[model samples]
Target: MSEPPASDLTARARLRMAALRLFAERGFEATSTRAIAAEADVSHALLRHHFGSKDGLRRAVDDDALSAFDRILAEFDAPATRQGLLATFGTVTARLFGADELRRNYLRRSLLEGGAASGELFTRLLNGTRARLAMLSEGGDVETGAIPDSEAESDRLWEPYQVLFLMLGPMLLEPVMRHTLADPVFAPEALHDRSAANQRLLTRGLRAAPGDTREP
Candidate 1:
């Protein structure tokens, strides 16, 4: 048998990554500890040693990802200007959909395939998004006259819940969207372009005219 090549990634990290990927693809109940160990190229004993148990491993992934999410939120500063709003939104959006496919997939599946866990995840996401928007609103970054308001604009505005639903739904259905949309707009490989496109739309209301009374 050939020896495995040397690599910098630790066994524990590999296990966590593998667990994340498998859990995202197969959901937590469907994924097995044995599969995680095999995917990580480590012994099952090692998995037990590092994580204590499969449930513990799941918690670890959640803890690690949430910790990173906290840092991402920390990057969102109270905006001093409309430009600042755009910059902050762009940064947060890109980070949410960053290279961490495991976190992204887990989040998407949790939303799409609802369960008890999905409710918890949604609560966390909704609170975080609301806080982010509130901070921006207070800081005078959320509205910049880019989109003229409706008569009841302030009262009729969809809250952060609606915003998150809009953001996460498409993300969870990306694979379907990629083929179904059949446009470069849905290109999985071109997230930069996609985010840029989103930025533009967000600045202006979806209405053909800024004063259009249609709901967004």
Candidate 2:
């Protein structure tokens, strides 16, 4: 098959962006292809021509949003020091979520609305978390001397979920959190502080190097 014309690709991208915005604002069931087409300044027939249906368009949007995290996840495929890993998390979180309101809102809706797509997204996140933890554990990137073996079984089993909750809590709650605290949680400075605090907490609470005295 021949490659699509450049104009066709541009129209497709516009439709996807429009769909993302509408879905974030009004949700999937409420938003229509016509509205998306109007938002993109394209015809409804063009939307159908590119993505077939609203659901197909949504899948395209989901795939595009998830691709960013896939790149972030790929960074963990190789071994790194515990701090290096944590630094990556901090940097990426600040960079990714802090800058992209549309993507963040889209994800918040997708995750909280509860659907097959949401479940799939959560599963992808869980798998990524597990892979990162495995790297930390198997590569001896972090020491778990702070945790006792007597309780290690359950901790090992549930750590990924726990970590994800910690990571996602602020993200999902960012709007409410910002309202309640009167703080911009995703601001660069705030994100940097949060990341630094996370690094400190993980370092002292879980991955302290030998004889390193750090107060939690």
Candidate 3:
């Protein structure tokens, strides 16, 4: 297909940004193409012509977000030691969770209302991140390793999921944790500190596990 004009591309980008913000604020089921179009100040026909449908637009947003995350994560070279792994993970977690308020809001909305799409995106992100972690953990034991490549493929596959869940738990549970906990400590800044602490604990535990000979 011939390349769309630059103006069209710009419009598509605007629509995607507008849709993402609106969806994050109002949710997927509640947000409409017309509303997104209006927010972007573009014609409804332009949105349809560019994205084909709301689902298409959502997928595009998901893809772009993930791609951007990947790009940011590419900066850190994988680490071999458990401490290094934790530090690496912490760095990445900080970047992902430290996104601007708007993006974080949108991501929260996606997690809440995007259903299968969100799950798929989460799976993809986890798997990709796990692979990187595994690569980083080369030469380390399954128990002590950051990613445990020696484990069964099924177990190995879950590493990224575990890491992601751990990283995302604070963001996902902040509301409930804040409500139920007497002294709430789930704020983003606090989560970052806790994540670092958890990583240190994980590294120590891993190093202490039976059959693990890795030195501190």
Candidate 4:
């Protein structure tokens, strides 16, 4: 297949970004094609030429946002020990969420809105978490007996969900968190601190030491 012209790629990116911003701020149901086009400073006809419609633009945005998670998961090409996996996940999560406010907000909105696209994104994250946990378990990084009975009874079924929540809970509750804490949670300093704290929790949970009784 022939690649699109450079101008076409640029326009498509602009339109997708515009749509992402609007969707995050005003929501999919309320954002309009013309409004997105105007935000992009492109004509409505140009947006249609690139993305077909508002829904198409949204799908593009979702794909773009989800692609980051895909890249993060791909970083685990080789199985890592429990501490190694936690460190990698913490670094990537901080980098991903701290880099772009708009992208972060878009993801938060998508997850909170709950739709087909949102479900797909959440499923992808959850599946990725499970895969990483499996890698640790299979690599003998996680001692099965060390896991608490509450988590191990169901074969550690809820571990993935817990990990996912620790990773994304701030994004989902940013507004309330900011208000309550009186700080921008995604700010670089705060994000780094949050990542470190989350990694500590994971480290405690996945520690394989025989006598360490630290709670995660």
Candidate 5:
């Protein structure tokens, strides 16, 4: 068999990146392969040759995002103090929220739509998040004590999801949140500041209590 041509590979990568950005912005249904090709400055035929279909392109984007998130989560070290936990969460929040518009758009699509593809991506995200939180709890770094085993047995364990959501949900909801906050003292900068403050509060609230040694 012949090796794949370098130009073809480059075109495929470009297509994937373009699709990711567009999907993040316009969502899957709204974005077409032709639009992705246009965004990448490639041809529709080239996109189809590389990705097979729009669903295939979305899967690639999902894989790319999930891999990137895993790398970010892996970098998180367990925080040793309540303040440290707050700072760690703040750092994570900032990084995720700071993602380029395209990535944010793709995430929104996954959340708003529910089907095999979106469901798989959502499951991967949730699992990755929980695993990272479990690492924090295991290391005894999170200020919050080990979540009680009985409570954690629920399918929708709240703490991990709560933490992850607080970090990301605001960005997803920014448009609506911004409109809702359009009162006195509700400037965009102030909203961001308040969001940051809320992250700190959540970090502090989630920390293990002093003298609690139970493991998650």
Candidate 6:
């Protein structure tokens, strides 16, 4: 397909595209505004005009990555049944694995290269997930027994973030996880199946059975 004309693109789009390429290649900390500007073929003033600062640009990148995931939550306000929750959860998990290359690399770097640079982004992302979970619970998405009485409300809140991290294994572990699973164990086309499996377990709650020793 032919590409869209440059005239059809916004300054923010250009800057974001430049930032994604530069950050993925150079890491967020190492990439400078000047370098991004040069890559985008735009003046530094334009970057400032649109994103305000490097931090602002990085926030935009994270928001762009999360936008799709957030949209699923928005679409199904209450997710009234277990199946609804599972299906929605499945979609969210799939997005993490199937995210666009730029988003995948940017988030991988932000999460693995953790420091002050990514702290704000992860915090914001987690908090948003928690808020959405709260909404779901309030809307009756969660049924009793889905979570045990012994677990604190705080622990329940972190469940979605835990799932988020697990689904990101492809980026965090790279070839190691792929090699460990191998093609036979987890076929390349089984990404959605893997995501569905995660949702099934996650939606089932964290209560341990008699021999369970997984909890810290």
Report the number of the highest-TM-score candidate.
Answer: 2
Model 5 CA deviation exceeding 4 Å by range: 1-9, 81-87, 140-149, 152-156, 180-192, 203-216
Residue-level lDDT tens digits of model 5 in 12-112 = 88888788778877778889888999988899998889889999998898888777677766777877653455346545654654554456656766777
TM-score order, best first, reads 2, 3, 6, 4, 5, 1
5 or 6, greater by TM-score? 6
Could you estimate the TM-score for every candidate?
A: 0.68, 0.77, 0.74, 0.73, 0.70, 0.74
Question: lDDT tens digits, residues 1-216, model 4?
Answer: 123443665877878877878998998888999999998888999999988887788879978877776666556533234444555565666567766678788888888888787798788778877887777577545444466776566756776776666658777888888887645887778877877666565656655476554644
- Superposed model 4: Cα runs more than 4 Å off: 1-9, 76-91, 131-156, 205-216
Query: Which prediction has more favorable TM-score, 2 or 6?
Result: 2
Better of 1 and 3 by lDDT: 3
Model 6 has how many clashing residue pairs? 0
Candidate number that wins on TM-score, 1 or 6: 6
Candidate that would win on lDDT = 2
- Each prediction's number of clashing residue pairs: 0, 0, 0, 0, 7, 0
Candidate 1 runs further than 4 Å off: 1-6, 79-91, 94-98, 137-158, 182-203, 209-216
Candidate achieving higher TM-score, 4 or 6: 6
Off by over 4 Å in 2: 1-9, 76-91, 132-156, 206-216
Please give, for residues 1-216, the per-residue lDDT of candidate 2 as tens digits.
123443666988889888988999999889999999999899999999999999899989988777766565555533244444554565565567777778878989989999887898889878877787786667655544465776777777777776676567678988778877645988878887777767666656766776665644
Report, for every candidate in turn, its global Cα lDDT versus the true structure. Answer: 0.66, 0.75, 0.69, 0.72, 0.67, 0.66
lDDT of 6 by residue, 19-124 (tens): 8778887898899999988877789999999999998998887777678557655766556554445456556545544645556667777877878867877777
> What RMSD, rounded to one decimal, does every model reach?
6.1, 5.4, 6.5, 5.6, 7.3, 5.4
What is candidate 1's lDDT per residue for 1-216, written digit by digit as tens?
112332657899888888878988898888999999999999999999999999889778877666666667667666554434544555465556654556777877766667766677777776777777677678654445455467336623455655565456556667777675546322344666656555455555554574543323
Task: Report the error of model 3 at residue 11, Å.
Answer: 1.2
